[model samples]
Target: SQQGEEDPQALSIQEGENATMNCSYKTSINNLQWYRQNSGRGLVHLILIRSNEREKHSGRLRVTLDTSKKSSSLLITASRAADTASYFCATDGLNYNQGGKLIFGQGTELSVKP
Candidate 1:
């Protein structure tokens, strides 16, 4: 499986602090997307950075993609209790062998303490 795997497995931080998570994949990818899932809820798309792009930002969320390293990182600034969730990185491989499927990481469970 070329699915990405998130590092640290879990994270714990206080409200107003910053949270960072890393994802590493096995194969080439065309684009990578970050998604957040609250307990027992569906995943919500956060940001997407193409393979050609190095960095992107949306509000307080920052994403960096390093294709050369087959890795990506997600940074959430000024974290809040509401931001507590499992963060997953999904990637669409450069080749369409998977029929345009997005391989997802195991996810990093984040906890924000108020």
Candidate 2:
């Protein structure tokens, strides 16, 4: 499968702490996207890095991609309770339409203690 797999089924960190999550995939992809899901809420797009790009960042989030190894990592610096949410990585296949049919992995549940 071209799906991405994230490590650590869950995580808990104190407010102001940093949290890191890693993902690994099995096939080549046009791009990879990271999303945040708050409990029952819908997933929110966080960042997207193309296969040609090595890294990208948004606010307190940093993401890195290594196509050779088929892996990606997400880093949240200075995490807050508000930052607590489930994170997932999805692959955008070679085709745009195909990419839209995202296959999400078992996410990493994050809890930020206030």
Top candidate on TM-score is: 1
- Report lDDT (CA) for all predictions: 0.94, 0.89
Residue 68 of model 2: what lDDT? 98
Instruction: For model 1, name the residue pairs that clash.
Output: none
lDDT of 2 by residue, 6-100 (tens): 99889999999999999988877888989999999999999999999999988899999999999999999999999989999988778666637
Clashes of each: 0, 0
lDDT of 1 by residue, 75-95 (tens): 999999999899999998888
lDDT of 1 at 113: 100
- Which TM-score value belongs to model 1? 0.95
Worst 10 residues of 2 by lDDT: 95-104
Candidate 2: RMSD to truth = 1.5
